[model samples]
Target: METSLRYTSNSRSLKIHAKEKLLVNSRTRLQLHGELDTGTGAPSYFCAMIRYFNPEALTILGLGLHYNKREKLRCLVRGKMEFPVRTGVPVTFNVKGRCDFDQEFNQRNPKGAAEFAWSVMNFQEDQSVRLKVGYEIFEKVPYMQIRENNWTLNANMKGRWNLRYDL
Candidate 1:
């Protein structure tokens, strides 16, 4: 379990987050995560997921909720798969997708985005240094109030390297 409260100087808001994981057998686990922001109109998010692991792969399915100050709520469905690659070095590949819907479960206005992403991570022999590369595409919701039928498509590719050390 983990919990944190942070104050944002620029936004002058307090953000709270909590996460917990439970073992539901030898190969299954449940995770719960939630976040809230005290900034006006900011949305609060909650997610619950169950993960299943086997010798070769891991799979996760989750449901999420987003609630705003106006009392409007949106629902999200997410799924992910991770597997180890047999490359000479230690590597893992991950694929994930998410679908968003409005309060009425319609993929329209105010909350309609579909995203698909994939990533590959390479780890050092000691597992302290890692490199990751990922790409994602989004069927995004329009920013302007032109029409409910208008939508946008976007894509992004990113890479990052990190070094970890224990104190």
Candidate 2:
């Protein structure tokens, strides 16, 4: 089966595509490939965590930073894993990012700005997933600094799957 999922965080967003080739050896595994995009303007950071279901237990994998020019900070992650059951499966992941822009106007009085983002995902029993993301920004001068600005996002995702057989 082949499926695709997407997520948007505070400073980053990702799309995950997966394909299930066969059910054999009493096990089923999916191959996953995904791309992540970082927000524009200023320096942005990206990070993510992936979880898989296995007979032994739930396994977690972490991904580092990936960048692309045309996409303006694009990242790719790929892997394979097996699921315990074919019934409704649950998965969870998290992504985070930070951006900072600071320039020195003088020796003591410098301009500084920073932005931070965090996201979470939860897959339920109905083949639907819930997502949440939050962002915050702060700007400062040598003597004074502005209050931090914060924002949040909430979303639900539905995935489509296709199955293939080989003998």
Candidate 3:
């Protein structure tokens, strides 16, 4: 369990979050996460998740809502697979995607956007220990009157790599 409050990047709003996780069994778990941001029409999020896991694979499914609106619903699915190399090193691959839809206030056509991300992480005792390389793509979202300008799609391409250390 965890709770937190923080100011947004611009310090224009306060963000509050509460989260908890339960280990249902040796191979399954559940989580609930909720957040609220104080700003004009800023949607609050509440998400519930279920996950199944083993030593070599994991899968997760989540459903979420914004401000309790049916139109402000979203879903996420993610999976991870781990394989052991002949050299005794282990590498893991993870992929996840999320989508959101609009109800158009019951007036206009419904539209939505999606994003996908994937990463490969190699774990070795030497040579950088743990390293991850990843890429992400976001569907282009057009400018609409009610849409937030900050969400405009301009430079959507992204690639990232990270090195992890326990020290």
Candidate 4:
């Protein structure tokens, strides 16, 4: 378990965060975290995430809840999750979107936060090089209720060699 509250000169926000992790079994773990941020035009977030890994499963399963304190900008409750497998080859899938809640936690507003996204990555490593390729798109709704106007679609490919041994 860990908890912290701090300020950064590079960003104009005061943040408080806490996280806890417990081992349930040899191949399962649960992580819980919450964060409060007091910044202009930003939403505080609370997230609880869990992941499971097994050789027979041949992949890792992850899921979590992402809560937002600001109702005027984003969905009050969003879900964040991902799946990745690397036993033989490396691949990953990711997603995030609004939950069943629309308004803030208070239920005063009847609008669900309008956002969704899906992404995938393929990664390869060799004795001398590492490469990764991925793409993602964020689905947005402009119904005058989201009010945040956060939307983007992106893709990238990269190759790099490790350079940290100071040779």
The residue ranges of model 3 lying beyond 4 angstroms of the native Cα positions read 5-12, 40-43, 58-70, 74-76, 82-93, 99-133, 138-167
lDDT of 3: 0.45
TM-score of each: 0.52, 0.22, 0.46, 0.37
RMSD to native, candidate 1: 10.6
> Where is model 3 poorest over a 10-residue stretch in terms of lDDT?
144-153
Model 4 global lDDT (CA atoms, 0 to 1): 0.44
Q: Which portions of model 1 miss their true places by more than 4 Å? A: 4-14, 38-43, 50-55, 64-71, 108-127, 139-167
**Candidate 2 C-alpha RMSD relative to the actual structure:** 15.4
Across 74-154, the per-residue lDDT of candidate 2 in tens digits comes to 333333333333334332222222232222212121122222222223223333222322221222111111111222233
Q: Ranking by TM-score, best first?
A: 1, 3, 4, 2
lDDT of 3 at 115: 25
Q: Which predicted model would earn the best lDDT?
A: 1
Question: Which pairs of residues collide in candidate 2?
Answer: 1-162, 68-74
Worst 10 residues of 1 by lDDT: 143-152
lDDT of each: 0.51, 0.29, 0.45, 0.44
